[model samples]
Target chain A: MKGWIYQLKSVRKDKFCIMSFFLPVLVAILLNFAGSIDLSSLGELQFVLTAGDLTSETTEWLARYGTVMICQTEEELISEINDPSTNLIGIEKDGKGIKTILSGDEWAILQQAAGTLPLLYEQRESSAQVGVQILSRPDILAGYQHIFAAMTLVVAMFMGCTFNAMNIISEKEEGVVFINEILPMSPKEYLIQKIGIGFVFGCLSALITAAICFRLPFARAAVMLALLVLSAFVSSLIGLFIGRFSNGLMIGVVYIKLVMIVFMAVPMISYLAGVENRILTFLSYLIPSSATLEGIMDLANGGTAMAGKDTVILAVHGIVWFLLYLLLAGRGKKQA
Target chain B: MWNHNKGNRDPARTNHRLTGKSCKTRSIWKSLRSLLQKDFRMMRSGKFFAVALGSLLLYTLFIHFAYVRFMDMEIYQVYLYDPAGTQRNVSPLVHPVASLEEMDRILHKDANSVGIHVTDGKPEVSLYTASKKLDRHRSDYALSLLHPGGKYTPETVGGNNLEQKNRRDITCELLFIEIVAVGFLGIASVLFKEKQMGVMRVHAILPLPKSLFLFSKIFLFLATDLVFAILLVLCNVGLSGTGKILPGLLIQTTILSLVMALTVFGCAMILKDFRQFSLAYLVIALFVTAPVFLSANTSIKMTWIRFHPFYHIYMGLKHAFFGIPVANPLYYLCAAGAVVLLFGIVKTAFCREMEKEG
Candidate 1:
C-alpha cells in the first residue's frame, strides 16, 4: 500500500499512459459518428458511365434512381475526371445483353434497378406509388459501437500487456528488481500490485471508452468495467510471462504481436464464433477478447453482461494465466 | 596496451593506400553487407525471423484449412414470423419463428438479420437497418424469397463465384492488415531492442551514411513482407491465381510495407521507451484502419475517405487481388513520396536520439 503512491506517481508522468488512454477512445467516438450516417438513404448518386452507342432508353432507365451522364470513353466519366482515383463505371453493349464495370453491392443494386427498368417501361402509362417500410428496427449504432468497441478493447489490452511487460524489464535493467526482492513484500504481493494497477487502468479505459462510445446504463457500465478489469489482468499475465523469459527489451513485444492477433482478431470477426469448425469456436472461449466482446454485446442489448459460458471461460483464462505468470516469475527469480 | 593497439592500426599507411575514400558502389555494398549482418543478428536475438516464420505458417494453415471454408458463410440471416402459416413457402434460408416475440428476440440477438412480418396475408419487411441501401436490399431479399420469379434480375457481377469473391476480398484485407499492423510492430520491436542495448550510441560514431541503418531494417522487413505475401496469396488465392496478381501485389505491398515500417521507425526513435511506443498503437491503428475498412467495405461511407491516404492504398491492393492493378501514376507517385517523406522524418528523429544518448 505504501509503495503504490510511487507507482501512481510514475504512471502519472508516463507519456504512453496518457496517450494510450485517450487515442482509442477518440477513435471509438469517430467510428460511432461515422457509423451514424445512413449512406443508403442518401438521395441520388450521380453515376458517370460510358458505353458504345448507349441507347437513350438505358440512359432514361438509370435516371429514375439518379442523374446518369454518358461519356464516349471510360476516361471521360465526369466523376473519374474530377478525382484521379475514382472507380470508372462503364456499360458494355454485348451480344448477350448488357454488362457493367461494377461488382459486389454496386452490382446487386444495379441488378435491382435493372429489374425496375422493365417495370418502368411497362408502367410508363400509370402513376404508381412506391415506398418501403423498415419493420424490425435493429439498433445499427449499437452493433457498430459493439464491434468498434471490441476492436478498441483489443488494442487497449495489447497496449496494456506491452506497457506492463516493459515496466518490469525496465526495472530489471535498472537493478530495482533486486532492491524490491529484498523488501518485505512477497512475490505474490508484488505481482498483485502490478496487476492491480493494470486493473485500475483497464477499468478507467473501459469507463472512458463506454462513456464516450456506448450509452450504457450505470449497472451495465459497471459490469463492463469489471470485465475489462479481468481482461486487463489476462493481458498483464501475457506481459509478465513474456517479460520473465525475454532475453531483452523487444523480445516480449515481438511475441505479444502474435498473441495480440490470436487473442484479439479471431474474436472480432463474430460470425466465426458460429462456424461448424469446433477448434475455431472453441478458441473463442479460450481467448479473453472473444468472451469479452460477447459480454459487451450482452450489456448493449440489455442482457446480463457476463453470462454463464463466457464468464466461466474468461475466469478460467484469467486464473490459468495468473498461475502461469506466478510460476514464471518464481523461476526467473530463482535463475537470477 | 594502448601503444600496442596504436601500432596495429597504422592509420598513416592505410590512409595512403586507400586515398582516404573508396569508390561509391563498393563502399556502399561493403557497409550494407556489415550493416545487414548486424541487423540480422539483432533480429535473430529478438526472434523476429523465427516469429515471422511461425506466423507465416500459422496464417497459411488457417487460410487453407479454416478461413477459406469458414468465410463462405451465409450473408445475413433472414427471420420469418407468419402467425397463420402465411409464409408456408419460406425459403430454407429463412428461419421461421412461431411467434412475433420469438422473431424480436432473434433480431435483437443478431442485429444483422432481416425479418419478415406477415399481416393481412401480405409480407412486411423488418430489419435493423444498417444503411438505406442495405435496408432496401434486405427488403428486396425477403420480397424475392416470397416471390423468386420477380421481374427484377440480380445478375452476378464479377467473374469469380461467391466463394472465390469472399476468399479474394478477405485474403486481400487480411494481408494488408498483417503487413501494416504486424510489420509496424516488427520494425519498432527491433528499434526498441537497439534503444535498450544502447546500440544507437555506437552507430552515432560509426563512419557511414546513417540511412544504411534505416535501410537495413526496412530491407529485412520488406523481404519478410514479400515472403508473407507469396505464402498468403498462394494459400488463400491458390498458385494459379497468385501468378497473375504477384507483380501488382508486390508493388502495392512494398509501398504499404515501407510506409508503415518507416512510420513506426520514426515513432520508436522519437518515443523514450517501449511502453510509450505501445501506447501509440491506438492512434496508429485507428489512422490506418478505421477509414480504410469503413469506407471500402461498409455501407457507411465517409466522403472524406477519398482524402484519406490509406483508402487509396487499400483499394489498390484489393484491385490487384482481383486482377485490376491500379494504373494511375499519381497513386504510385503519392506512395513513393510518402515513403521518402517518412524516411526523412525517421532519419531526423534517429539522429536526434543518437545525439541525446551521446
Candidate 2:
C-alpha cells in the first residue's frame, strides 16, 4: 500500500531475489524430511536368532521389524540365514549386547536394525517396583520443524538482508544513487521503503517456513510472527550497515558473512543448552536470530507466553540497528 | 621447504656502490613473504582479521563456559502420567502429573520430552514418534525409568569420561563447521576484492607466480584455522587433554582447510558475484553439511553418506580429537588429490577471470 510495495513489486521481478527467498526454505524442508526417513527397512531379509531362549514377545517384535527365523544351533542358524533365499542377518544373544552377523546387499540395514536391540531388551527386561504412565512427547514433525524453523529463519533473514543491502550498495557502486539523492523525497522515507521490503521478505520467509513446517496454535503463531518481524528489521538494518562499506560486492560479502556467522552461531551453540550452558544460553538471547529461535523453541515446546527476554532483545536489536542505519544510510553518502 | 624452486633475482640498484650489494632470498620465500604481506594487508582492510579474532574469542568463551556444561546435563525430560496410582517407585527424574489431561498439556508444551502414560497398572508410552527406530529408543527409555534395567549390562568401552568425550565431540563439530563455512567464505570474499580491483589481471603481468596469489590466501586461512583449532581444543577439551592429540588435530585441520579453501576459491573465481555465491553457500552449509551431521551424529542414516567427502573428513577430524589419528593412507591421498584437483580448476578459472574485460 505504501511506496515500499511498489518498489518491491519491481524488485520481485528479479529472478535472483525470488530464488533467494525460495531455495533455502525448499532445501531446509527437503533435508528435514530426508533426515526423518526410515533407514531400517531391511527389505526382503531373513534374520535368524539363535543361542538363547528368547521370549515369544521378543520374537514377535523381531518379526515385526524384519523377516525373522528361529533355530537352535549356531551352524543351523548360519546355514538358514545364509541361504540364497535370504538376505542374511544372524543375531545371537551376546553377554549383554547382541552379536550381529551379516553380509548382504542389505548389510547396513541389518546393522541399524540390530543396533536397536539393546534398548528393546532394556524395555523388555525393565525392572520396577511400580508401573510408569504417560504424559506427552513432541510429534516427530515438530521435532523436525524446530530445526527447519531455525534453518529457514537464519537463511532467509540473512540472505534477505544481504540482498536488500546489496541492492542499495550496488546502485551506489554503479553511480545510480547520486541521481536519486537529489530527488525531493526525504532520505528517511526512501531508506525505509528500500529496507522495509527487505524486512518484509525476511518475515515472509520466516512465516512461510513456520506455517508450512510447524503446527503451532494460532496465538503462538502470532507471537512467532511478531518475533519474525522484529528479527527481519534488525537483520535488514545490519545488512544496510554492512553494505555501507561495499567497495564492491566482495567487501559486503565478507562483513555480511562475519555478522551472519555470529548471528547463526548463537542459536546453534544454544542447542547444547542446560544449566551449565547458562552463559551460552544467555549469549544466544543477545543475538536476534538466536533469540527468535528460543521463542520458536518455547512455542514448539507448548509454551503459551512469549519469552520476555527474547521480546526485549528483539525490540532492542531492531531499534538500535534501525537507528544506526538511519544515522549511516540516512545521510545518503556513497563510499568513493 | 623444497629446493626445487630457485632464488629471487636481485633488485637492480641504481647506485650499487652506495646501496650495498643486494642479497638474494630464495624465490619461493621472497614471493611468499610479499604475497603474505599483501594478503594480510587486504585481510586487515577488509573485516576478515577482526571478524576472525572476534569469532575465536566468542567461540572459545562459549565452549569453555557453556557447551561442556550443557553437554553434561541430561538430554530428555521424562513426563509421567499416573492418574490411578499406577506408577510407584518412579524415577525422580520423571515428573509425575495428576491426570492424563495434565500430562497431555505438559507434553503438548514440551515435545522434546518423553511422556509415559500409566493406565490400568500398565505403563504405556505416549508421545509423537519421530521414526520407528527413534520411537522404540524413546519408548525403551521412558519404560526403563518406570522399571529400570536391562537383561544385558552396559559396559563403558572408552577411557575418556562422558564429559571429556562430549568436549572432543562438540569441539570437533564446531571446528569442522567453522572451517567449511567461515574459512571457506574468507578466501572467496578476499579474492572477490582482488577481482573487483582488477588486481588479478595486473598480477598476471608481474614477476610473481600466479599460483602465489591463491596459495597466500590459502596459507593465511590455514594458519588462522590451525590457531583456532589449538585454542578451541585448549579451552574446550582442557589443557591436559591437548598433549597427545595436537599433532593429529593439526593434520586433520590442515587437510580440511585445504579442501575447503580450494573449493571456495574455485567457486569465487567462477561465480559472477557474491550474491550467487550465497546460494552455493546455502546448498553447501545447509544441504551438504546438514545431512552429514544427521548421518554422522544422529541415528538417522543415509545410505550414501559414506561416499560424501565431508563425511570422511568429519570422521577423520572426530577420530583425531579422540586421540586416534585416521591411519588410512587412502584418506590422506584422497585429501591431497582433492586439493590438487581443486587448485587446478581454480587456476584455470582465475586465468579466465584475469583475461576478462573490465
Give per-model TM-scores: 0.77, 0.69
Q: Please provide, for model 1 over B83-202, each residue's C-alpha lDDT reduced to its tens digit, 9 standing for 90 to 100.
A: 887656555667788898898788777776777778877677667766654555455555555543334453334456545666777788888878777667767777887888788988
**Clashing pairs counted in every model:** 4, 10
Model 2 docking tier (incorrect/acceptable/medium/high): incorrect
Those runs of model 2 whose alpha carbons end farther than 4 Å from true positions after fitting are A1-18, A28-142, A170-180, A196-238, A241-255, A258-336, B1-29, B73-154
Listed models, DockQ each: 0.27, 0.15
Show model 1 residue runs off by greater than 4 Å.
A28-137, A140-142, A150-160, A172-175, A217-222, A225-239, A245-247, A271-283, A305-336, B1-25, B73-158, B351-358
Cα lDDT of model 1 overall?
0.69
lDDT (0-100) at residue A130 of candidate 1?
21
Q: Candidate 2 residues B1-358, lDDT tens each?
A: 3543323434354456335433333666788998899888987776777667676787777777876665432335788877887667766668887787887777676654677776678766776555454455455656666654334322212355546766777788889878888766766777777777777777877776678888888889889889888987887887889988999999999989888888888888878766677778767876667777877664444788888999898888887887776778999999999889989998888778766742
Q: What share of the true interface contacts does candidate 1 keep?
A: 0.27
